[model samples]
Target chain A: MTTPEPDRLFTPPPLMTSPALTPPGLTPPPPTPPNGVPLPYQAAPPPTTGPSRAPVVALSALAAVFALVAGLFTALYLGERTDRDTIASTRADQERTLANVTGRQEQADATLETNRSRESTLTTQHDLLTQCVEAAKGYFALPPGQTPESSRLFRVMYDVCPQI
Target chain B: MTDHVLSIPSPPAPPRPRSRVAVVLLSLLVVLLLGASVLTIVLFVGAKEEHGLEVQRLDRTSRSLTDAEGRLAETEQTNDTVTDRIATLEAANAELHKCADPAKESIIAARSDDEEALRPAVRRAAENC
Candidate 1:
């Protein structure tokens, strides 16, 4: 298997400093590169066909990240600010509405007090009327010949106040 | 065309594998950015939640205010009814005064076998005996 068959040969690519094309005693291969790695090209420079990069791409990605984060933070900030403002506005509205309610409550309290006072006065009047009715009954209860002073007293009691 | 013979030599071993620190850094940074993005999304959602709670609170307050308004109207109606009752009582009190007036009693007494004109309550309480 060391030698190829006569039909076909598959040629392999060469290493960077290989000497297959060079004569055996022509000279030692050129000195190795100072870094011990071989030069990428024996003539001219590396092919311009593969990926090429600078740190700018990473920086650009980082800048894009910053922009995205900043945009998001700004959006959140504005949204929260708007919500807080709405809450403040709503609270003001509630306060105003509550003030009206408080005013109505005050009016209701006044009306209630007036009603209570009226009820108290009515109770007093009712008591007086009851006393008048009792006095009228007593006046009518005077016997067949009551004293003149008693008659005058009975008349005064029943005449001045009426209760029904 | 010329027939040029080509000699093949062994290919060099693949270049030594390089450090992947830059890829790792970019991956870690992307992960960090994704995390920040998630947190930003949460903050946005939290804002909506706060507003939602505000809306619910306002709705509750509105309901409470409606209830209070209804109660106030009921109280006002009650006041009107009581006021009307008081007015009726005042009118009744005025009418009772005419019956109970003692100055007219003398005229009624002088009349003969009198009291057909008197209300039942006055006749019942009259001292004819």
Candidate 2:
């Protein structure tokens, strides 16, 4: 007995039609048998619907990875910003300390300058006082018979002390 | 009739529930990615600007500290010198007073004597006192 042919009623219809049946500007359909029977072992055309789930899932995973990277970058930036704030605070403190130190140094410098001037005046007075004392000692040591007005010691005393 | 019935394909299988869920999840991930990227860029720029300002402030503070330290050192040195000079002047002044007072007494005692002796004592006292 001959093998029974596939029943046309039960055979599923081809999803695509022939190129002649397709409209212009539209993709032509793959070649199909005139009787609308699919050849055995022929591969089905790819679906025209949207992308499959695998590529979508992969793209979603990639997006998740990018988001994770961005989150990590944000965390790092925040930490660095905090560190910068800390540094800025420290710098401000250092500046205040430096200002105080500079003020103190300036005051000390002024004190030193005043002391130096006083010391110079004191030294000059000390030198003149010493010379006057020496002249007095020499004049008193001279003999009583010597005339005081013509003496070198008396002249020195007069010059150093005009009050005499 | 059978061909007509077969030709009319059954309505496309209803979209899978899981696929819809995946699309929603993908959209949420994209939004998350964009938000995170924008936040990262903003934070990065803010951090960079702060770093620049901090560096400038730190450099200025360091220089000021250095200058202040040097000035303080020089001031201290000058103060020491002045202190030493003051001590010397004080000692010399004490010695001068010591000698002047004694000589003044000697001149006073001589003033009661004869004119020849008294004249030299008067002149000496004038110079010393």
Candidate 3:
């Protein structure tokens, strides 16, 4: 097998003139004159009908509708967002108020507990004071010789009421 | 021999009027599509952010309310306890006064010099008052 010339190997085949050999949907090239010049008088392919306006118009209309709907939705969303933000802000304010109220409540509870403790202490002190008064009375009523300094009533008065 | 010359093809027919209209319509469609797309994206993003913030705020509010309720309940219980304690204290105070009054009078009436009477009175005051 002789190696073909490189130019011949790369050269494209002549256009197919046989209609049967042409690929489907492809028209065979028109025959050239013996002079090898193609005729320029060949009919121009019927002016390619520009795509019908109806489809593009309909598509444009649909797109316009989509754009309009989108615009409306955008407005609605904006309003919704504003309303939601307001609601969120209100809720935040409520949270702050609740926090303040809770803080106040805790303070009140602490104050109440302190007052209760103080009141209890005061009540206890009052009871002790009353006992001390009664003991002093008893001590003073005792006759001079019989009134021993070591007596329980004297001790009670001295412990609770040093002023006496 | 005559010279062979190739004739130049005429310029392609000007674009059809209908095709120009179609081009304009397609362009409009593109613009509308772009606008719709941008709007949709903005709406989606805004809604997402708002939803997240709203949810967080709602959660915080809910928690705050729960805390307030708990505090209120605690305060009420404390108030009731304090009120009951105060009532008890008052009653006890009244009882203390009841016991001390007559005893005080008796001690006051007794004479320091009267050893026999004073001794009994002092003993009764000490034991009961």
Judging by lDDT against the true structure, name the best candidate: 2
Give Cα distance to truth, residue B18, candidate 2, Å. 6.3
- Relative to the unseen true structure, what is the C-alpha lDDT of residue B11 in candidate 1, on a scale of 0 to 100? 51
The residue-by-residue lDDT of candidate 1 on B1-129, one tens digit each, is 112222335455433233245555666676677777777777777777787777778777777777777777777787777777677656655544443444235335433345554454455446321
Clashing pairs in 2: none
Q: Under CAPRI classification, how is model 2 graded?
A: acceptable
* Per-prediction interface RMSD in Å: 8.5, 5.5, 7.8
lDDT per residue (tens digit) for residues A88-157 in model 1: 6886687678768867877986787698678667756655554555555566666656888557746655
Position B45, candidate 1: lDDT: 76
DockQ of model 2 vs. true complex: 0.37
- Residue A20's lDDT within candidate 1 is 70
For candidate 3, lDDT tens digit of each residue in B1-129? 123333435666666785777777677777777788677768867886787779787887888788787877788688777877777777766665543543443444442355566566556655655
Point out the worst 10-residue segment of candidate 3 chain B by lDDT.
B1-10
Sort every candidate by lDDT, greatest first.
2, 3, 1
Please, what is the whole-model Cα lDDT of each candidate in the order they appear? Answer: 0.59, 0.69, 0.66
Candidate 1 chain A has its poorest 10 consecutive residues by lDDT at: A43-52
Global Cα lDDT for candidate 1: 0.59
Per-residue alpha-carbon lDDT of candidate 3 for residues A1-164, written as tens digits (9 for 90 to 100): 24345465432245455667899997666655335544556565665554556766777777777777777777777777877887787787888888788877888788788868867875785677577667766665666655455387756654554321
lDDT of 2 at A146: 67
